[model samples]
Target: MSNATVRPLGYDLELISTIYISHSKNSVLPLLVASLMVNDISIIAIDGDHIDDVRTMIDIIQHLGAHCIQEKNRLIVDARDLQNFDANIPECSSTRYSLLLLGALSARLGKSKVALPGGCDLNRPFDFHITCLEAFGNEITVDNRSITCIQKHSPKTEFSLPYPSVGTTLQAIFSTVIGDSRLAIIIRNTALEPEIDDVIAFLNKAGAKVFRDDSNITVIPVGRGSLSAVSHEPIHDRIEASSYAFAAVATRKVVLLKNCPVKLMTQALTILEQLKCIFYIQSEHDILVDGRSIEESDPISVVTQPYPGFPTDLQPILAALCCTLKAVSHIRDEVMPHRTGYVKELEKIGALISSDGNKITIMGFESLSNAVTVNVSAPDLRGGMAIIILAISNGCDIRIESFNQILRGYSRIISNAHILGGAISHEHP
Candidate 1:
């Protein structure tokens, strides 16, 4: 008996592919199609192959909420069986992008209850969500499974956060935005990582009382006010772009990345430069990172934060990529505090690495030999794809369990891997 069944258990779609590849879609297609399925827009993809494109899909779902469907079912969601009974999940509460959902769901229901999100392998001890919600005067109850918020007792009020947890901050907005519409908070030590400012800007646009200084964020909700139909494009998914960019680096080859949103990669590009690698800025959306043989004694320091800083999400991919570098490297995961994983898979390919808590130490191998169908699993999105990158590169037949984790972020991994000349195709586990 195999750990993964020949069929995906309770999953919507599965892929069986041989083409080393992914297909590119106009980034806006999913948003346009899913949001306006009843209108001129229509959503279609060749197969499960293009599903790894995460950011585009997020943006599409967000935009779709504004319009009401006459023939709500008219929008044809035509695609091959990514799976049967594939429930088109409306954008609600998600652990992956819970921060993105906070204000939106709060607007829909004065209180939002997100089933405890499950992804990644991090020991998320930061009770910032509960702490922040309590500060906002909302009654919070945490059981084994989910955190529930109730507002029947407290006067519509305000609260503050000690840490700038992205999800907590968003939840604050959602809880106070309705009724009184005058909810304010002081967010302390909150995440100020890259792209968070954009999220703040979106809140401000919705007629919320949102103000941020060097220290704290304050929000006054408009009680489900109507936001003007937004017509702006989303910032490119820096995390996803960085993952694929690292894939090219892992290959020790030069692959041109179009639409890469180069500015957001300050942390990653800087590391590559410190490694004496080369990257040519082709355009706002294009970057060419040149990989070279790494040094044996190169020491690296990594810490995770919100936006405009090292992303915690990239820690796993960075660790995996560093495994092939010539030098011994170090990465400390200050954000989620998960011991850097995914690199363990590299050991199966003949690399040496060690991790404790959030800290990781990697000793690169001269070359990684291929695997012969190693049973593997993806802890989270980044680590999942990182494993796939290492697996396919080693020319081993890899069984990546829980590929759905990869799908939570990337739209299509198999198709893109093929495009990058990787001999990867999905199989029924």
Candidate 2:
């Protein structure tokens, strides 16, 4: 339609659709935390898409008495002149990453007062991070308003997390990387997410020694003046690439995702194959997906897990695609219970779906046709993207309220839709 190529809802595009996503939400926050650990000014040249979250981080940095200047994708952070360590998390800036600032500030400033971190209602708890900070020998107090951290002495050299949590592992690393040079922090049960590996590499390049031995991440602080300014490029967004692939499956188009990190997406690729979706790896960094002939087969089952397993982040989009398949599909999300909030929205447009707690079941439909106008609410980031997939698969007009929810994770989404020949428009109510 609209001169883009002719194909059924789930067919191959005549031309390859090239989409470039902005930097990852997982990368930007850690880079900001790394800047706080150093005593010297660090110039970070970052490239990515999520502008709102980036702006919020920059504001938090400025609030902490660090100077930041941005031009295009690069940000120059002048932390050499940092004066204040206390960060006030405004409601507009209530992101979960804001919690990591506590570890960075306490490591350098001796104390910090930060509001409780906020973000998409994912039911994420802070007890794991609290355990990491307590291992730093810091006195912590929590009230309804904010969290207070006061550093007292050198932290314990080793600790263990109740679960392999990325945030907690990062907290352990950030809080200890600024300790005495002789101190080595060992964390057991550390998360093995690729993003964490990239953050470790960035810190290592900045003069800190961070390595992995088995299931542990060890961080050794070289000294207060050890870090050196360095430019780093974050790994490509694996979640974004997977989202595009799922979109292609739902819409039945041959879409090409360029510059994808195929190595990190093995589980996603395996699930795609199970769905009877025709896809192939064009290269290590590219994938060509032919959704033209999705066959009705056995129901594909998915269980969300940490990295190297199926990612919890892409669960919603994949679930949306299940609605378009010929057989019933099942998804179990142990990471986030509310991740399926968009299912009701899909049902509004004629989808056969049911849920029990964190598990969801979707019965495929031959086609979904809606004559009446429909409006969907996006309560979270991934859920917002799910409804958009529904619109594409159903070939129906969908008005998404609070579209900004999707912006927190996706960059240039409207442009991406246009490039893929999707009819998506924004309206102010």
Candidate 3:
């Protein structure tokens, strides 16, 4: 058995105290809609806090006519009071969640006009989303500015997605759950992400039948029944936990992350083990990481894939780690080619990096000078975190512009950093 006791680092640099990672936006948005579609008054109790994207999803849900009250992290939604079927989605609130709204709104309201959601400039095309929804009988028109959806008729229950796109898969499940009659949905080539499982669990708990297999998820109505209201808490943010883990390793500190769902982070933990990271799984809810031996590991090459693989979300942080280490490393972001743009920004902080297409080559440096006041633009969320880690590791206090990009995913940034003994602050310019 792993010992629960942990020792603090002797270095003057601050180490992370225990931290409770917030609920995942990826999990919360789907659960929010699943709860709303049950056609009843219900209280969806969210346990932990989340970022701006969760709030954006809530606003969209309210605009679609559900009366909702948000107290701290809990949302009390009254779906019976829905007045307007047409949804008015704001531009700033645009995200992949909009696609999920399309599925849920088409089932509940039958029509919606949602603006295209803005996110990291990954240049991910919406064609896959449009294709999957269109296959499910949702009349969708794709325009540069907005997407218009009208449900002409109930769709066929069977679907075989060309790719295991998480957004598309969720759209299928959300649309089918609230149909007028008994329906069965078979989603093949599904994304087996833990967040997807959380959605399935939420729906199943609320009187929907969802089964998971190797590469597919099947959803069936429970005894000719529509969805019912539910109260649920999203799983802890695995990406957030992984980010702090990488930070602990790179900074050579000891950190105990609270409520870290280690089972969901297997792939990431395997990679960390390869990096000579010493970790103790204290319990189902916590993990102790000692990064003192991180310098002993060999250079590693990583490729980003769907779940059960290295997450694309952590690729940038790993690249940042290569900067602080003594070995050359290669990171291939097969998931999003646009993620490589952050490599250019890291150059300003004295990283020897170059990119060719989707792959990034990092030539590790012996030493780096602190950047006193270099202006850095946050190209995306994970990229923004990468730059911040690079700056702090080099003993530099820097200002990052466009930091709201980070806020879309992470909450209480300055506060969390301060708790970890980081001298960081955020201000609007």
Q: What do the candidate models score in CA lDDT, each in turn?
A: 0.54, 0.79, 0.75
lDDT of 3 by residue, 1-429 (tens): 776977895434355466677777678877776665667755665654557677777787777777888788688887876646555456433566766667776766677667776677888777777877787778888676678888886676777887887787887787776664466777789887888888887787778777888887777644323556777777988998888788777666677888888888887788678887878888987988876767543887999998888889999988887887777789998777678868878887777888999999988643455535767888888898888777767665667888988888778666666544467667865
Off by over 4 Å in 2: 1-14, 91-93, 365-370, 427-429
Predict model 3's lDDT versus the native. 0.75
Instruction: State how far residue 331 of model 1 sits from its true place (Å).
Output: 1.5
The C-alpha local distance difference test score for the whole of candidate 2 amounts to 0.79
Best model number under TM-score: 2
TM-score of every model?
A: 0.73, 0.92, 0.91
Q: Model 3 RMSD to the real structure?
A: 3.4
The CA root-mean-square deviation of candidate 2, after full C-alpha superposition on the true structure, stands at 5.0
Position 193, candidate 3: lDDT = 81
**Ranked by lDDT, top first:** 2, 3, 1
- Sort every candidate by TM-score, greatest first: 2, 3, 1
- Alpha-carbon error at 30 in model 3, in Å? 2.2
